[model samples]
Target: MDLAQRIQKMITPTIKDQGYEIVRVQITGAKHPRLQIMAERADGTCIDVEDCATISRSISAVLDVEDPIEGEFTLEVSSPGIDRPLTRLQDYQTWAGFDVKIELKTGIDGRKRYLGRLLGLDEEQRILIECEEDEPHTLAFEDVQRAKLMLTDELIAAAATEQTK
Candidate 1:
């Protein structure tokens, strides 16, 4: 098997047993290895850093013992962060109503990039993002080059700051 596949196979279950989901495995240049593992409730809301760090250290230690690599490699374990990657249909489903950025395979509004709120996702796994400049663009999940949540702490705080605005 390939390196990433091998690592995932070895590490995923151990992580899952500890209440963490191995969202994905990323290996770049065979030297820098990062595992994007997310800890969430069964319903899938995000988890805090304490849990993430605990899981990270434990997973790293398990990997160290497994000796998946023949030589040197780095294991970085952390949350997916605010601009979380959209790697699965459920990921899109869970984050609906939140602002996100989607990169389509081809241009929809004379450009390839779109940033807006995710209205909803359908059974076909198409992403429905309501852009600022146009209607809700439905791009097939398979067609998404990259998708992630948009950073808007100010936006979030504004909503929380003034109950009546």
Candidate 2:
């Protein structure tokens, strides 16, 4: 498994016990590697600074013991904000009807990126996106390199509604 995957496996139990679920784990940079852990409250509430601090401390303790990284690395814990990434398959269903930007690992129809309304996943588990084309484009889940919600008034309003819940 990759470094980020390994780290996620190591930290998931602790994070879940703390009532949070990881959105994504990414390790970037060479000289000064930065480990970014995006998480959200399992209760469907917004996570705050205190939650990030708590997660950071807990993850720090776990990493110190495991020593997963060869050298010193910066660990960052934060919530996936309003325009969050669609990392898991459930995210697509949850955020259906929102505008999104999806990039594929390889070009499809002479394009690598697509911007349109998210139609969620089809029966075959492929991502469905309605672009400028007449019909919705069906994209394989494995082809997606990265996908995230587009920042729009509708999304902002939805986020506000979620926060108040």
Candidate 3:
């Protein structure tokens, strides 16, 4: 497995035990790698500074023991924020009806990028996206390269209401 995936496997249990979910784990920069761990409450609540600090300490302890990274690396723990990434199958289903930007691994119909309102997953587990000009596009789950919600007034309002609930 890759470095990020290996690290995730090691740290996920600890995060889950703390009532949080790992959204994504990314390693960037070849020379001085930066490990970024995006996380959130299991109930979909936003993470605070205290939450980050807590996760950081927990992950640090695990990393120190595991010795996953070879050299010096910076670990960053943070929330996914309002316009969060759609990294898993459940994320697409959960964020249905929201505007999203998705990049495919390969071009479909001469396009590799698309922006549309998410229609969730179909029976075949394909993601459905309804664009402005045409019929909804169905994408294979494996085809997704990157997907993220688009910031909008509707999204902001939903987040605010979720916070109050």
Candidate 4:
């Protein structure tokens, strides 16, 4: 497996034990590997720098024991930025009514990109999105490639206040 995949496997349990979700993982950089770990709360409140630092230390402890990588690298545990990726089913439930940009593998409406307010899930396990029209668009769970909760000013303000404490 790749470095990101390796890190995710190694660190997921530790992250979850701390009540955080691993949103995405990326390992980039040639000479020195860089591991970027994104985490968030169920309500979409991002894991902040302080949170990351705590998690980072825990993860670093594991890395030291496992010795996954032969050479030196940088470990960056962080929150999924403003335009954070929506990867899990719980993400849909948490950000209901928030605008999301979804890219489908196959275009259902003759287009791949969809920008709409999430309306939660339906009985059929499809996401109910309130698009431009009054009617809601139900997109299957398998369709979304990458999605992020569109951050409103209120969200930013709340996140800022959260960090202050």
Give the best candidate by lDDT: 3
How high a TM-score does candidate 3 get? 0.97
Alpha-carbon local distance difference test for all models: 0.72, 0.93, 0.95, 0.81
Error of 3 at 154 (Å): 0.5
Leading candidate by TM-score: 3
Candidate 1 lDDT over 1-165, as tens digits, reads 777778878877777787667655667654554445544534444556687777778777877898876676666665665566877778888778888988878886578988899987877768888988877888888778788888788545544553343
On lDDT, who's better, 1 or 4? 4
Cα lDDT tens digits, model 3, 1-165, are: 988999999999999999999999999998999999999999878899999999999999999999999899999999999999999899999999999999999999899998999999999989999999999999998998999999999999999999888
| lDDT for position 137 in model 4 | 79
Clashes per model (N, Cα, C within 3 A): 0, 0, 0, 0
Residue pairs clashing in model 3 are: none
Residue 54, candidate 2: alpha-carbon lDDT: 98
Which ranges in model 2 have alpha carbons more than 4 Å from their true place?
A: none
Clashes by residue pair, model 1: none
Encode model 4's per-residue lDDT on 1-165: one tens digit a residue. Answer: 777788788888988888887988887888998888888865556676788888889889999999987799988878888667788787788668667888888898697878888888888878888879557778888888778877888657755786777
Q: For residues 20-138, write the lDDT of model 2, one tens digit per residue.
A: 99999999999999999999999656689999999999999999999999899999998899999999888888889999999999998798999999999899888899997667898
On lDDT, who's better, 1 or 2? 2
Candidate scoring better on TM-score of 1 and 3: 3
Which order, best to worst by TM-score? 3, 2, 4, 1
Better of 3 and 4 by lDDT: 3
